[model samples]
Target: MDTHLKMIDFDFEKLRPIGLTQVVVNSLGAMQDTTPPGSRLMRIVETQRDWFTLHDGDAEHRARIAQRLVNVLQMQDSTVTVGDWAVVTEGGADDLWIAALLAPVTQIARRANDGRRQSLASNVDTALLTMGLDDDFNPRRVERYIAMVRAGDVAPVVVLTKSDIARDAQERIAMLRERLPASVPIVAVNGMSEHARTELMPWLHQGQTLVLLGSSGAGKSTLTNTLTGAFTQDTGGVRRGDGRGMHTTTARSMHLCPQGACIIDTPGLRTWRPDADGAALAAAFDDIETLARQCQFRDCRHQGEPGCAVQQHIAPDRLMNFRKLMRDAERSEQTPLERIAIRKKWKSLHKAGAVRARDKRR
Candidate 1:
């Protein structure tokens, strides 16, 4: 494929409307009937501290939206990210500054280690949860990712990589199917094959944006090269002993696919603690949730209580997993006082349990 033709796949008209809440945007909408000539709306290809590389459908160029002076929006932490729509001001000799940021229709975000929201990208249609079928294959971690993607309201597609070496892969796939919601699609493929690329084309349709997510050594970058039809991202092998992969892709970058979709490859997450509300967590465990509704108590903790439908029907391990997720969510959202009280309660229970164990021994 021609380089220029591949570039055309990054369709701005089709892509910009996604995550763009309103028809008219850029804050300038209030001031005028239509966007002015100098104020050009562009989609971000990449973002940096001072400037951004923007795409306007036809071409890509380096542009900046803010002047040297600090602005109220930036102060409010309304910063631009890759895939964000911004209105750029044209200046002499290609000088441009971002004028305003439009509201995103969908945003992929997570809680940063500091407890702040880290917005990964905007306007994405699909979140490809890439997992190596080798040692990187983990059912629990995949469930965690499903919760995160579902919370963002993005479609989650599971991609199991390294199928060439995947022994008894079908059995593992079956386990995932039983664990995940039936709505989520799963595909197993070797990352190096054209056949694998062919299988992925449905999700890589024109104007769609997909984000790659997985732990280090899960073959995300390897799959990215196949998607781009070029060696666009750097690739490396996992350790033979433990099958752990070193961080090959350290930063977030978007690549254009020949099939007309935008694929953003992200760094392997060392910590993937997601920040979500109660509804989001429940969505990931619909099987258990549906049964809980039939329980006798509204606040049915799913412990061995009378008329406990969840405890009666659900597996103990899955039920325990649900309870653990709810606990984690509470901890993440709790205030300082609430958290301290909860911590004290747990400590008291631990002390009682220790006393019981000693008594039994005696």
Candidate 2:
């Protein structure tokens, strides 16, 4: 097979009998294409109904092949589902063929089947949490996104959209800065302006992968179209009163930016559940952990402890935010057993500290 030059212009013959090395450009309708020798594939271009516009080279094509692959493979191995980029190698191709060779191949194996984990996307470096300045902005929602990204071992960056509509943009940005870790980048962007492109340009450099996540009507699709320099996805109008757009984007897809960065845009989430443990939350809220270390007791709740160092050094408002997050973490805990254990452990520690304080006063 000839080594095609463009990522999207692959010769069908070059596709190995096993599987092709392609990125899911449109996940809703299953569009995908094989990368030629020199060209690269990026993440999510556009989503509409079951079809999606996937930018493979300079031109965007609509197809459902990628989605078909995901569905068939998932039946055999749920982990084989959509979202990852692959460098189709001879050896890897052979393994896939063998996996496909099994009789009556299934896309999703029963839970009783052998342990096999499928991946949504591979080689992802970062996850961009995009929230609109409109009514969609919620600190709790951002926290949920952070947890999910961290659980996937991907770095999270908060992208605040529609800054042009916000009267107190600086104030809102300051609030996020206080609540979020300093390491995470918080960028305010107006999708309609060139300024937004400039602010996001640095992150779009080659070899990087970014995923856009937010609630519907948060301008996620608009941002995707803005980055790609075209009206790739259909734009939906937001409700005038609530500023929520009708869930225009319906699938998860990947697209490659002109600069070589890969981005994945997912459908707006109505409710995001962090399928992770407390550790990811702890990492997201490191400041709270540092304050907790100063508390009189190892497990001080920071509610009203006599020698609570958290209450002493941290501002009252900051403490309240910390507590609220901890409570949210408790609520997000997956298993009842885990929640019960965490509750019991904290209760014992708080009770012991209270008893010690009473004795000292006597």
Candidate 3:
């Protein structure tokens, strides 16, 4: 058997329709040389507990990670996610096995509340940060999503869903425009309408992969259905009063849009703690960072610091949100040992304070 895979033997053309660009193919450098016998390059459309749905731009197939690849993933503390390209082989009895995965050009990820890093989607070009204009409307939450998406090197588009019902849609959009960078696109649309397909046409071009990230009842599934021109995903309404979604999208799955693009609809993220460092977090809120540079103090935290330019110029709510996100980013950057040491120090202080309180009572 040849150690080198003959490029001619593999039909790379078959994978082009499903977002296989020359750039991704070029990134395959050494991975292309290690192709197993009788293997095919496929893109993961959906990932479940122990299996994945793969597509070669022609048909979909079910596959599980090959034991060899699973062991490698375990060692790296990584799991395969949607929008990933995989090298798959057909085992006996028509069973498909993913032997290896190509490196993703971009990924949307976040640090969970438990301090674990989770990959939402990979090889994504743009992220549609869907948010409802109703009670679910939250500019700060949208900022967090933008930070997470931008940290992954993916373009962020704010999609304001439920525009038909929300009377203050324009006001909300204006607020987001003022809060977010001008470069970020914000589109308001009713996700269930055909107008949504027209409004989002720019990002729905051929060979592009887009991911929907937002809370439940934000209309991700509705947007997915509209884009695909079918009920590919189920849609549900938000709960009354609180307006929280009912988790209609249980898993992340990729659907092909009628406009020749791929859309990965993810389940609503209940708690999204961005997995970014100080620099990345700063990059997300460039406006505040720009203002911070003009402060009189070198390490001005913008919290009532003398000559703080950010405090004077930026909105109070936006500034507060940035500070909170910065704290979260710092916490997420801590190592296990560093976290343990801090916990122990805090524990000691708490114990000392309790002892003093007891002495005072006596």
Candidate 4:
């Protein structure tokens, strides 16, 4: 056959022109060998969903794609998330045309309220947890947000909004720094000003993903608007009695910043359920952990226990903070038996769906 004719054939097959001939030869070679070439011909799938919006690239993308694949395979989606980069078969010949051009796949699961679940955003390097200094500032709430972000293995950076509102901004910052791990960067900013943008510039690099989390009236939406340089989202006033803002942002949506970074903004959560356990809580409260290790008992509660290393070395205020956080974590943790039960419930629900489908076909 003429070289031009071969090139035309390759284009018709939708394979890249440069490697067309080599691919054909390789396929033939594989077919002639003892092993089947099925593995080489499969196409990986990628899907994304965000909770705040039906649009793609939100936190929900991870869950949606995972569920779809699991349903297709008649298995649990939670077990096979987007991050695993699984092998899948092409549905038809059309996939073969574009199969070679596919990029590495990463699936993200959706956020769920009933229990701890995975939410993935591909290529996310940082998770920015925002809180305003007005009525919305709460150390306990920040701890919860930290746990959620850390659960996803994303680096957490705390951004304090509405710094202008605080009478003593530095004092507030010091309190937060004392409570949170020193490694986590804490920045207080006036969201509407250029100063805030300057402080956040380093994390806004292209291709990096960040998620803004806070309660209503915390200035997360304001910060989003400020960072994007446009009134892309609506704003609402906070309550007069308390500085807490109304729940204006209803969904989690991802936007591309002018600087090339990607950000996911979620609605103000009135109640945040942390999806992590002892280790994540420990990391969030490293100082407490360090002190606890010095306590007399292997399992020191830090309450009235004699020779308690935590009590001995740490200040009363710091110990109180530690105890409060530990109690919060204890409430958040699910016993092994409870987890098993929850998993079984989900599996049963999936099984029932399968049975219904089989009956419909029959």
Write the residue-wise lDDT of candidate 2 on 147-263 in tens digits.
567666778789999899877788888998887778888999997676776888877876566678788888877887888676767777689897777988766666656666666
Better of 3 and 4 by TM-score: 3
Candidate 1, pairs of clashing residues: 19-104, 19-105, 64-97, 64-98, 65-97, 65-98
List, residue by residue over 1-362, the lDDT tens digit for candidate 1.
Answer: 11111112223354442332234343334534433444656678777777788776667778866653237555654456677776667677878777666677677877776666677877778999999888998877887788888888888999999889978788888887877778889999999998888889898877778899999999999999999999989999898888888999976777888888888888898777667887787798888888989999999888777999988877676677677777777777887788789889999999999999999999
Model 2 Cα shift for residue 335 (angstroms): 5.1
Residue 214, model 4: Cα distance from true site in angstroms: 0.8
Residue 104 local lDDT, model 3 = 88
Model 3, 1-362: lDDT tens per residue? 22225531245566666898877777656775676667777899999999899997789999999888989987876779999988888888999899888888998777767776688999999999999999999998998888878888999999999899998788888888888889889999988899999999999998889999999899999999999998899889989889899999998999998788999999999888877787887788898888889999999978888999999989998888888888888888899999999999999999999999999999
Question: lDDT for model 2, on a 0 to 1 scale?
Answer: 0.59
lDDT per residue as tens, model 4, 40-119: 22111133332111211222121122234445444332432222222222245423211121121222233346655444
Residues forming the 10-long window of minimal summed lDDT in candidate 4:
51-60
TM-score of each: 0.83, 0.64, 0.94, 0.64
Candidate 3 segments exceeding 4 Å error: 1-9, 352-362
Task: Report lDDT (Cα) of residue 201, candidate 4.
Answer: 98
lDDT (Cα) of model 1: 0.76
Off by over 4 Å in 1: 1-37, 65-78, 91-93, 340-362
Clash count, one per candidate: 6, 23, 0, 15
Best by lDDT: 3
